[model samples]
Target: MAPRSRNASAPTKPLLKAPAQIGSLDAAALVGELRQLHEDAEDPDIERMPSDNELYGALLYAEKHAKALAMKQGTEAAQRSAAVKRVLLWEYLREQTDLHQAKAIEDARAVKAEWADLAPVLAVSTPNAAYNKAKRLQAARLIDTAHGDRRLRRTPEAVVEAERRIAAQALAERRAEEQARQRHQLVLPVAQRLLGHRDGLAFDTDAEDWLDEMAAVVDDCHTSTQQVSLARYLGATVRALARLERQTGKPPATTEAARLAYSAAVELLSR
Candidate 1:
């Protein structure tokens, strides 16, 4: 008989590891390595690249290995290697700083921060200077191409494109925020009503003790992110309640308000 095709087989290995427990890593060991490396091979551009964790780690690893290699060379060659490394890093950071600075300005404007507030931080003498710097950085990020090494164009057309993009982003954020607020306002009352019967129906039986904490959290919430847990808790609780009710010939809620709340909570579970 011919052997079965390997591709069609169920296979010999387990498909999952539940996160695959391999060699373990810890933060203290990684931080110790970076701290030691920084003592000798410090790169100032590391701070400028804070938004990119993966890139920062890769650069640090590359630096560690390359610095070891450079040390094997004579002193003069090592110095030259270090100089080239710094210059190449500078070129990369020069491009990235403009992009990140532009994003920071957009984030500041999103929170209604004024140029006056940003002037000192931007290292500028006046609010006008700060605003102009923001515009320049903003334009630098959108130019079609770099004119030369360290020379990025800020043409009128690029500035217009940047302005349009910023405006659209701000508008979308506002609309999304408003929609979240509206949805929260609508569902919040229903959740509160369901919790109103919590003492009489929910706590009477041995349901999870977390309902108490969830009630307090929902009561104090102001944002949609904070409010998500209440709906999720309610949805899960109602499903459990339904299963219990079906297994025994008894309803989860006996009182009129509670019966209504059970149905209401279940109906909005998918929402």
Candidate 2:
């Protein structure tokens, strides 16, 4: 045998392994390793790394997927929070409104009852303008009779002064009575407004903090621009009260101020 070929041995083929699991590894490192394995399996002949455009596409896909997942999770969380808050606030507002409304109604009823009870007494005491005039005429006649029958006659100066004083006092008393009647009438409308305000204020107390956000899905009341309407009204009421205080020489604790505040709160809450 001429020099037998030293060794013509067959080459053994290398076995390919599956991609790594890398579950415990950092995601960034794992992704890098996965890309290397992909390149090796696909084309080991390429010397340079993958193209920038390919890496950019991968990154964009990953970013988009991440953003989508985050958005989904965030939305789910927000919805849960809103649902819970709505339930809690609904109960709170209901209780608050009902309680305040009941109290207001009770108070109003009491005032009405008191007024009713006093009406006859007032009518009996003051009567009408015509009756009041008659009473004055009767009193003047009695005084004149007394003057004529007096044991001691009155001097001219004293009599004239007394007559003038009596006329002045009667006029003053009549004006005072009219003013009191007017004030009483004014109180009725004011009381009604106050009751309305109290109802509204109670409603607003529950959601004043989150009304704007809650208003989107909750539609108990209409809102301007789907935002918290009460906030503006509350502020406006405060300013209005302040102005009233300045103009009327009264403080914010006055019934009118309280009523305005109540109205503002109610308008906002209802909206």
* lDDT, each prediction: 0.59, 0.39
| TM-score of every prediction relative to native | 0.45, 0.21
List the lowest-lDDT window of 10 residues for candidate 2: 12-21
Record all residue pairs in model 1 with backbone atoms less than 3 Å apart, i.e. clashing: none
lDDT minimum window of 10 residues, candidate 1: 13-22
| Superposition error at 141 for model 1 (Å) | 4.9
Model 2 TM-score, 2 decimals? 0.21
Best by lDDT: 1
Q: Which ranges in model 1 have alpha carbons more than 4 Å from their true place?
A: 1-75, 96-173, 202-210, 267-271
Candidate 2: give the clashing pairs.
Answer: 200-266, 230-268
- Candidate 1 residues 139-186, lDDT tens each? 555522222222223433446544565578779988887876876776
Q: Backbone clash tally for model 2?
A: 2
Q: Write the per-residue lDDT of candidate 2 for residues 3-73, one digit (tens) a residue.
A: 76675322211112322221232334433543443343342332344343343344433333322322432
In terms of lDDT, model 2 sits at 0.39
